[model samples]
Target: MSVIFGLAAAVAVVAALGVVVAQRTLYSALALVANMVALAVLFLTLDAQFLAAVQIIVYAGAVMVLFVFIIALLSPGAQERLHPLEARVLIGGLAAVAFTVVVARLTLNGVSVAASGRFYGRLGPFAPVLVDRHGQVQTLGEQLFTTFLLPFELSSLLLLVAAVGAVYLSRRRRAS
Candidate 1:
């Protein structure tokens, strides 16, 4: 399980870097899809099967399709290159190194408490026993429909608005 998680984490990191470094817009989108799929695999290794499925279906499948469609529609040209010694490139490289060091340190020394005061090992209402008894999907669905219904609905609305905004912007661009 740890091996799978580590492999997925490595893939996610590499794909994330690929997304940022890929010259073509379509290649960047493909890299993003790979990153999302790798994240789904990581979730699976954590025993979050429902989250893994949702990650694959909603992000890797639906969101990637939308991004790829947009990229195809735009038909963007080649990216402009930056000189190796450019200030922006140097700053970006430094930031990447800083980020990597911070992540490495955190991984080596595990976080005990989150900024929100939640313990890292603390279980939520959906305990492992409950999850085993009722199944992960069932427990998650119950919570989504009951405890988190409003937030769930609001997020759906937000996504709908974003999709509509994207379509509107694309059409307006074509018209102009």
Candidate 2:
């Protein structure tokens, strides 16, 4: 399990670097997708199965798709290499390495799966909300709908605001 975690962490670090270092925008976006997937695996390694699925579904699947689509639509020549080995590139590389080291250390030292209060793995919670395969999903839904409802609604509202702002900016630019 530790070996798998290490490999996934390595992949995640490389992918994260690729996100910043790739010359082409599309390549960077693809790297970002890879990074997100590697992160999901890392989450799974920690027995955070629900978090892993959400990471893959939300960030890797939805967010990256939107990002890639927008890039493809907005910039025809986005594949062209813009910067090669600028000073910021070196700085970014150093920062990434530092960040990876910090995260790895924290994950290895601070996180403990067995210490989690909830019943994990094949164990049974058998609570009223759920009893089987959909236990995690049901718990997540309950939390989202009950405990975190305000934050969820706010996030949706935030997206709506962003969309409206984009349209307004585009129209304003066109009118100018």
Candidate 3:
């Protein structure tokens, strides 16, 4: 299990790096799809099957399709010239390294709390009162509605705003 997890993580990292460093938009989008698939695998290994499926379907499939469509619609040419490594880039790299070190230290030293405890291992009040045998979706829906309702509705609002913005931009472009 650990070996599989390691492999998935490694693949995800490489794909994510490719997304960032790839010269072409299409290649970057492809790398992003690979990264999303790797992440879905990781979610499966963590026993979050529902999340794994959602990761694949929503991110790897739908989102990547949208990205590819956008890339195809745009004129195929050098979008921007690559700049030489500057002082800001060096500083950003150092900051990223420092952040990684801090996160590693925190993770290594973190305490593993038992899930059966009163606090319920960080789930707190949001923990499911009764998990049905049906599947993760039921428990997730319960939590999302009862505990995380505000965030869920807010996310929907955000998505609505994004859709509206996309439509407005497309219309403006067409008009111009």
**TM-score versus the correct structure, for each prediction:** 0.70, 0.62, 0.74
lDDT (Cα, tens digit) per residue for candidate 2, span 69-175: 98877855664555658888788779979998998987765456546745445733434345345676677777788878999999999999999999999999999
- In model 3, pairs of residues that clash are none
Better of 2 and 3 by lDDT: 3
What clash pairs does model 1 have? none
**Alpha-carbon lDDT of model 2:** 0.81
Error of 1 at 166 (Å): 6.6
Q: How well is each residue in 1-176 modelled by candidate 1, as lDDT tens digits?
A: 87888899999999999998888888989999999999999888878899989998988898789989988888665556658899998999999899999988886555544445555566775887789999999999998999999999999999899999999999999999
Q: Give the TM-score of candidate 1.
A: 0.70
RMSD of each candidate?
Answer: 4.8, 5.8, 3.9
> RMSD in Å for candidate 1, one decimal?
4.8
Per-residue alpha-carbon lDDT of candidate 3 for residues 1-176, written as tens digits (9 for 90 to 100)? 99999999999999999987999878988999999999999988977788899999998889889888888788366577555697877887899899999998876555433333333345443234433354678878877998899999999999999999999999999998
Better of 1 and 3 by TM-score: 3
Candidate 3, which ten residues in sequence have the lowest lDDT sum?
Answer: 112-121
- Which ranges of candidate 3 are over 4 A from the true structure? 75-79, 87-95, 98-102, 109-134, 172-176
Candidate 1 global CA lDDT score: 0.87
